[model samples]
Structure formats: structure tokens, C-alpha cells
Target: MLRELEKAEQKWGGSNKLIDQWLENRRKLLVHYCQIAGLPPYTNAEKSLPSFEHVKSFCDLLVDYVSEGHFEVYDQVINACEKFGAPCKAAIQQVLPKITPTTNAALDFNDKYAETQDDQVLYQLDKDLSELAHTMETRFELEDKLLEVLHSKYSEHAQQA
Candidate 1:
């Protein structure tokens, strides 16, 4: 899926409406998986250990899955911005470097910590990972909003032209 997304980004950029819908679906999946996994505030220590472990396992899979999804979406969005020439292209260009490293680092750390079965460790990791996921969710949402704004502006420009 990541490879396909890369190709799409390279070939058509993320300007395609189909890619935007896919990205939104991926975001929804990530949020749903997180909720079901009982990570963060949803996590209760007093809850059955077996169940929690299962949820943890689910969450681990989700983190891995959604991390890849996010990477693809981000790559496509960046490519789209570059190709579409948004009015705010300069702003997006400036942010690319700072955003990529931060997201990558957080994903890397979460992936490593996710392997531990220890309750204390898992709980701590869950707390951190949950926060990270929330941040990612917010970032994606904000990016979508930016895309909306850009699309509207581009549409107006097209009409003028």
C-alpha cells in the first residue's frame, strides 16, 4: 500500500480527489483502532490483563499499519503541494523539513517500545503513544483543512483564468 501510494504521489501527486478520500479513510481507521485498543485514557489498569494485552496487540498492529498509512499520505500531500502550486506553497515548503523528522522520530520510538509486554512499560508507552497519535490526528486534520482552503483558492483562480 505504501509503495502504491508512493507511485501515486510521484505520478499524480496527492491532488487527486481519490487520494484525499483514501487519506481521510485511513485517518478514521487509525482513530477507530486506537479507541478499540484501550490505549491512553481508554486504558484501565484494573481491567482484565488478558483483554488489555489483546487490545495492546491490536494497538501495536494499528500503530504499524497506520504509521505506514500516514507516511504515504504525508508524502502525497507534500507532493501535491509542490505540484499544485498552492498560494501558500512557500509556507508548506518551509514546514516540510521540520515536520518529517519529528513524525519519523515519534513513530520510531513508538515502534520500539511496542514490543514490550511488561505492564508498567506498556502503560507508559501507551500514554506516550496515545499522545503521539492524538498529535498525528490533529496534524492530519489541519492538513485537510489547508487542502480545502487551497482547493477553493485554486478553483477561484481557475475561474478567473
Candidate 2:
């Protein structure tokens, strides 16, 4: 799957539609793998820990898939950011009604060591990838918030301008 993803990335600049299809296929493959591994989909946020080694392996695969330059996945990542923006913004949106502040403070603490400025060693390389994945996930979450605001404000700002 990683190999296919890399190929998609290489081909992405040449054909956007092909790249989009590849990304959609990648998402489907992820969903299928999740189901085959007996792991819950993204909606099952509460199921944090897994009982089996297979589940852990599957999670590792996802982390690897997300971390590498599966550059083709960038479009899907951006699309998800756009789609989830509203719920994220609504969680903190000042308009319509004020929403409660949910704590994401702990989220920042995850894999913080990944950002260390120390030189990378051989054994540390794999750990670095996992940490990078964590960092990427954090970045995507923040970008989603920004996209939500930009999209939600588009109409009002346009009218005013």
C-alpha cells in the first residue's frame, strides 16, 4: 500500500484526477483494513486501546501510511480538514451560540520528544517516524480549525466586502 501510495504521489502532478482517484482508493483501503483488522473506524474515538496485537499492528500500519511522503494523500488530508472544519469550529465558534471549551491540552503532550533538535541516530529513525506521524496528526487538527473558520466566514465576509 505504501508503495502504491508513493507511485500515486509521483503521478499526482501529472494528472490531478488520477491522483484524486488514488486518494479516494487509499481512503477506502484504509477503511477496509480497519474493518478486516476488527478495529473500529475513525468514529469510534472511545476505543483508544486495543486488546490484540493485530490491532496494534494495524495502527502501526496507519501511522506509517500517514507519516511517509504519501504525498498523494495530501489532497485527502486537506479534504478531511475542510469537511471536519465546521464541527471543529462549532466546538469553539463564537457565532450562533458559544460552545464549551474542550480540553486538547493533553493532545499537545503526545510524542513531544519527536521535535527534539538532537541528531538522528539509526535506532532512533523508526521512533522519529512515529513521532513525525503524531506531529502530522496534530498539524492536521489545527489546519482543520483554520479551514472551518475560513469556509464558514466566506459568505458573511463576501457580503460585507
Candidate 3:
């Protein structure tokens, strides 16, 4: 499967500047994630454990991404939806609640892991980070659904202010 982010880029990448920038930020997040997880171009032939610095750095990036979603993306999309009327409002009502858990989890993950050194308790931290990443992956899907709602119906009019 091509995955939500990649699929989203192809479908809505440049419909507007906000979507374009958001998707690009998402791409960078994923690549950094894969690097921390030792999963690809960041690696090559050998998988490596994430450094404590890498873990903290990724956590910071994750927090910034979440903040941007709430403070920037949500504000822009909801306002656009409002301007578009009922179906848009209905779609947001249906989707926003579902995204709350993901948002909370990302925040929780930051509080729980951001300052901790992964090497202090390597095994446990690795397991917990794995779970965190999985949650992040799922969260991205829910977010993409929210964005799709706006892009699918009102991209032409959703240009940022």
C-alpha cells in the first residue's frame, strides 16, 4: 500500500499552499521517524538504535507538528468549512472528535518520553517508542481524513489567509 501521506500528496499536494506545506512537513516528519526507527535511507544495510538525542529531537518535532495542526491547520480548515456551509460543517463534526485521541496521545507521548534517555532502560524504552510510533501512524490517517474532507470539497476556496 502507498500509505495515507503519499497518497494524499499525489491527490492534493498543490491544490493550495497550506495543503502543500502541511504535506511537505508531514513527509519530513515521516522520514525523520524512519530514521529514528532505523528504517531506510537513514540507514541502509544495518539497523541502528536511536540515540537519546534522536528520540528527543523526534519528540520535539512531533510536538511542533501537533501544534501546527491545532493552531494553524485546524483553524484554516474549519474557517473554510464554515464559509462553504452545511456539508462541510457536518463533515468536520463527524471527523474532529475522532482525531482528539490521537492529538492527546501525541501530547502524552511527548510528556512521557521527551526528556527520558532511551539508553537508561533500553529494552523498555524501545518497546514503548514502538507503540508511540504506531499510534502516530494511525493518527496521521485520521488527520488525512480530516484534510481530505476539506480538499475534496473546497480546495479551490480553502486558500490560506
**Candidate-wise lDDT, in order:** 0.54, 0.40, 0.76
Best by lDDT: 3
**lDDT score, candidate 2, position 119:** 37
Q: Write model 3 residue lDDT over 45-129, tens digit each, in one string.
A: 5545577787788888888888888889888888988987898889888877877787788888778767876466545655766
- Order candidates by lDDT, high to low: 3, 1, 2
**Model 3: clashing residue pairs?**
none
lDDT, model 3: 0.76
Q: Which structure is stronger by lDDT: 1 or 3?
A: 3
Taking every candidate in turn, the Cα RMSD to the unseen true structure, in Å, is: 7.7, 13.3, 3.6
What's the TM-score of each model vs. the native? 0.55, 0.27, 0.84
lDDT for model 1 comes to: 0.54
Q: Relative to the unseen true structure, what is the C-alpha lDDT of residue 161 in candidate 3, on a scale of 0 to 100?
A: 25
lDDT of 2 at 58: 41
Q: Give the per-residue Cα lDDT of candidate 3 at 111.
A: 82
* Model 3 ranges with Cα > 4 A deviation: 44-48, 155-161
Clash number for every model?
Answer: 0, 0, 0
When 1 and 3 are scored with TM-score, the better candidate is 3
